[model samples]
Target: MRKNTVGTAVTLCAAALLTAGLGTASAAPATSPAAAHGAQAQRQPRQPVLVDCAFQPQARPDAFILACGDGNSRLASLHWQHWDGRTAVARGVNLVNDCKPYCAAGKFHSYPVVVRLAHPEPWKKRPQVRQFTQLSLTFTGARPAGYDRVVTLPLWS
Candidate 1:
């Protein structure tokens, strides 16, 4: 049983890497004319985005990971109500793992939430991309244990 659990974790991690590699290049920011001309200052303001673990900039993704190193927490069934150059708003379900005995044996729990992305700043790792620096989730219904009705976390830059 222990061996089976390890195998499952390994398989899930492998799948994540594969999917990230196979993701569409269209998800990356397009090089604008100004960018091509090396006119960094003249470039039009690009839409703020959220980068996945793959480091791909996504304008409005259906799902997003809250924990990047592991697949323990994520936002699912995202329905974006607004996405502008500055901020984003959405309604989604926060799926979190309750790692009881262990992470591999954990059970996932769902919490209905209102999602907000704010503070658009140039990503330190990818300067060309404007990434949302913060994430705020207001739990509309159930939430993870030891969490507040509203939880705000800093997104990976």
Candidate 2:
């Protein structure tokens, strides 16, 4: 009877160890699902989208028309003269309307403009622009004496 009691105690102890091992293994698999989700998130990075001013004029001021009339002010053409990934120089035309009396009877005007695109620094405080933060427009040729030569517009309204 003494030998039988000792054997029963050893068997119980072995069963407890086996159960504990199985529990650890099952828990490891459960944790792997969460780990896989984390890996997937890390694999996907945020992609930057290029600005299209025709659709979002206020968002992309660099390519927007001045003095909009009946939503007719738009970027007619853009010829990229120089681009080095970070900065770009382009020549474009802003088809705007000179609202002499009002928008209903406004005349369309084509303005030649120089476009410059610059990447924004992390410390800049432009909440309206995303991706590229600095967009400057300089009107080519002659302009009004008091008119500004360079106009920096927000990427967003």
Candidate 3:
């Protein structure tokens, strides 16, 4: 009778441990649904803000630099020829650094470029006059051998 009582107590202890482990396992999945929704929210891309091209005439607004704040890429040395309510035509140099090994230790290259900004799409979010929908760039004269003549980039709000 004494041996039977000891065995029964060991069995009860093992059963209690297994029950506690299953309780913790089930609780982990209960929080997973909320975590999944939070991950989905993070996957959405934030809209890009519109920056004004109009700078002071003395400031030499030659280039429309699309730095995007990171300083990785930009348009350099732009001389605006015409800018109306609908279109802007400019001649500039597109300075891009090929960040091969790393960004800080990259070599900057200059290419002669003719940039045109047009296609005014209304920003439903801002509804402003200066906002635009597209920007087109044409590398003229002597660009790198295999580069495209025209590249259209979307400007979205």
Please name the candidate that would achieve the greatest lDDT relative to the true structure: 1
Give lDDT tens digits, candidate 2, residues 1-157: 9999999999999999999999988877454787887876454323222344343312223454443435656665777776553666778886666666886698877778887777733322333333445668788965334448887765532
Candidate 2 ranges with C-alpha deviation above 4 Å: 1-49, 53-72, 120-130, 144-146
TM-score of 3: 0.54
Instruction: Tell me each candidate's TM-score.
Output: 0.70, 0.48, 0.54
lDDT tens per residue, model 1, 1-157: 9999999999999999888877855478788886777765434237888878888778789999888888999999999999998889999999999998998999999999999999999988768778999999999987888999989998886
Alpha-carbon local distance difference test for all models: 0.88, 0.59, 0.64
lDDT tens per residue, model 3, 1-157:
9999999999999999999999989877555778887875454212222343332111225545555655655687778787665776778888776676787897777888887777755555544334456778798865544557887888645
Superposition error at 34 for model 1 (Å): 11
Best by TM-score: 1
Residue-level error in angstroms, candidate 1, position 95? 0.5
